[model samples]
Target: MVRTAISRVILGVSIFAWVLLLINPGHIMSMEHCHVSDSGPSVSSLHMLLEMNPIASQLTGWGLMVVAMMFPKLIIPIQHIYARSLRRTRFSASLLFAFGYMAVWMAVGLLMIGVIMGLHLLMPGSYLPVTGLAVIAIIWQFSPVKQRCLNRGHNHLILATFGWAVYRDALLFGVIHGIWCVGAGWALMLLPMLLPSGHTFAMLVVTFIMLSEHLEHPKVPRWHVDFRAKLFRMIVAQIQIRLKEAQE
Candidate 1:
């Protein structure tokens, strides 16, 4: 009961924070600038650090995004951990698991920033690189590798141990889950990263799409039929319902 309540509170806080960040126009502008700078290819790591404000802003922006976007998906796994863990260690294990999970994402965020910096250096003002990234992301959506990663993410193991084993298993589960999640959703995640405008909307859309993918049954990649048709229908139904609500 306590674990369930805690999970609900975490989800509520994450949603509230996400909404707050979405409305901040200034933060959006800063995030856009963080991806690609106007400065030439000569820019260095030291230079980026010297202009620490933007870096800090970028981290804050992405960190909030990770928390908001990833927390809901994490609820089930966390609840599972809480259920299996001893009462005295439940909170500690859960906290470590959450930290381990976010650590992977934070590392990935830095790597993404580095890639964007490289792209800015290479193309300066062209959108071709960003376009290519989007194309790659789209292709990745239908790839067999993505299906494999998604399957792994949904497959959970028994963590029925105690002491250091509990901590170890929790952290290990977090890292493994984080990796599979990134693998499964990197394409959708990249879409907002590449787009300079309407990032808040893009992020929200991507988050919804990623969440939807998890809700459906896992399928292996096949060339003959459209695998995402069900997902598309679900989205259309949601839009229609929202539209009707707005009109009423």
Candidate 2:
């Protein structure tokens, strides 16, 4: 009981740190870029958008990362476990993973910022992602393979408080995450690359939305999950049969 209490305290501190870094990334950047000016949009305009943002982007991203890192290699099943409750382990994992994942994305963001900044300097104009991000979002969400993977994970998770009916748990989750992530993100990263240049704010906004959606509940219905499960089972059965045939 005492050990559990200590773990919870540590986890709370870690989550607090993750939330702090996420909410104040600009402030940290400002310390380094102290000489920056009012060259961009006014504070009022930004404030209006900020007001409309219901989900705190940084917090959500950090929270999801915490969950991701908590289980390490396993993704959705743990996430499935994490999302539906106030489980303390999930909280701890979310907090720790946030810092680690932020370290990774911060580095990636820096590289992207430099590249885009260079383009802004050279071109002095132009931007992207504002117009086309939604289209790419729709396609990835509806893609056949991604839908298949999500269905499999969802079906398995619905009753999985302890273990899945399957033998290999980690492998199963990894496969689900690979497909889900492809559906959920990768293309969102391409938004920056796709945009004309100097649309850093736009890219960031889109990325934040993408990150939030990945962590949130699926847009579809619970009843919508059945078709995909059957398909996955059939595919697995077919593979098993082929393997047996080769042996014979």
Candidate 3:
């Protein structure tokens, strides 16, 4: 009962954060470049974006984004940990597990920032890199490696049953899950990171895709041509259920 309540709270918080981000019209940091002198290379907008926001502010934005986008998908794993833990340490282990998972994503966000900055420096005023990234994302969606990682994410490891072992296992589970998730979803994630103009919308789409993938039953070599058909069926079923509920 307590575990279910905690999961519900986490899901509610995630939904609330997502809605808040949607309603806020301002960009987290503007990606618009300013011209200092027309004769020389244009000043990079990334520099200004970084200068305008303190590191803490940037991290906060990223953290909120991670929580909003990733937390819903984490519910199952968190519940699993909670179920395996003693009542006294259940919440503590779950909290540490969530923290460990978020830490990996935070590191990924930092890496993405560095990559975007480098690309801005390398190819100023060109959308080629972004386009390439989008292509990569699409191709990665069909890759065997992506399917392998996704499958690994769904596999449960044997966890320890006592004291510090509980905490350690939970944290390690989070780290491993985060790593596999990143590997499986990084390409979709890059779409928003590369294009700031449609960041929110792109992120919404990616989040949906990630959630759908997670909800899928595991299969050996899961990346197949019929994957989209399966996802389509799942989506249709969900919509029908929602509509039926509304009618009732």
Candidate 4:
């Protein structure tokens, strides 16, 4: 347990540091550019310190998110065991499935970075990472899509299956967790992909939207219950149509 906690802390710190670096790469690049100068050498500002590197930022942020969302690995091993108990599956299979699920999101994260980078390249600047990440974060914070993500984080889970061992509850929990993550982070992840404007406005906007959800009454918020339902229904319908086509 101590080891796991230590690892979590390390992972969290590593991610936070990397993200900060990406957001301030210029600051890190020239430590002497700490601040404005009065006939003296300039210095890097706190902002530049945080925006040290974009690749590092993306990796750290996504890694931290996946780790946090994937805590069932240690917190609820029984769920995995339970899922296995229902079908007498091996431990290795559970690991494989859980990893496969994670792989899906990793791909999603990478796709987001790819899209963001493409947009950033077009902008062409020395401070691309800072502006790009901030913009993405802002959009995700305020957008209607961000509201759905915030709601999912705020809501509780629903268990669909039954009859699993106490030790195997991890698998069951894992299944639910897997679904929740993809549902919650899908559009947010797509922010990097979908948007062409490489600025932090999107990030700030999304942040405000999410912050509103946490409030008792959030006026001017992007999403409500209906928004989620509408998107979900559309998604379901699209999937059903595709399935029908395949079956036909």
Global local distance difference test of model 1? 0.72
Model 2 segments beyond 4 Å from truth? Answer: 1-18, 25-76, 79-125, 152-179, 188-248
Error of 3 at 134 (Å): 1.2
**Deviation in angstroms for 41 in model 4?**
34
Put the candidates in lDDT order, highest first: 3, 1, 4, 2
Please list the C-alpha lDDT of all candidates, in the order they appear: 0.72, 0.42, 0.74, 0.44
> Candidate 4: where are CA atoms >4 Å away?
1-65, 68-100, 126-179, 182-248
TM-score of each: 0.80, 0.34, 0.84, 0.35
Highest lDDT scorer: 3
Residues 32-53 of candidate 2: C-alpha lDDT, one tens digit per residue: 1111212443455344333432
TM-score attained by model 1: 0.80
Instruction: State the lDDT of candidate 1 residue by residue for 1-248, as single tens digits.
Output: 86679778779978986886767644532333234245545556336532643655666667778888778878778788778778888788888888888888888887776675566555554668768877887777778887777778786655647678888888888888899888988767766766656667888888777776766667775432234555578879999999999999
Clash counts per candidate, in order, are 0, 3, 0, 50
For residue 72, model 1's alpha carbon misses the true position, in angstroms, by: 1.1
Best by TM-score: 3
Model 3 segments beyond 4 Å from truth? Answer: 1-4, 23-26, 29-32, 36-49, 122-126, 226-232, 238-248
The 10 consecutive residues of candidate 3 with the worst lDDT sum are 30-39
Output the better candidate (3/4) by lDDT.
3
User: Can you tell me which runs of candidate 1 are displaced by over 4 Å?
Assistant: 1-7, 23-29, 32-39, 44-53, 123-126, 221-248
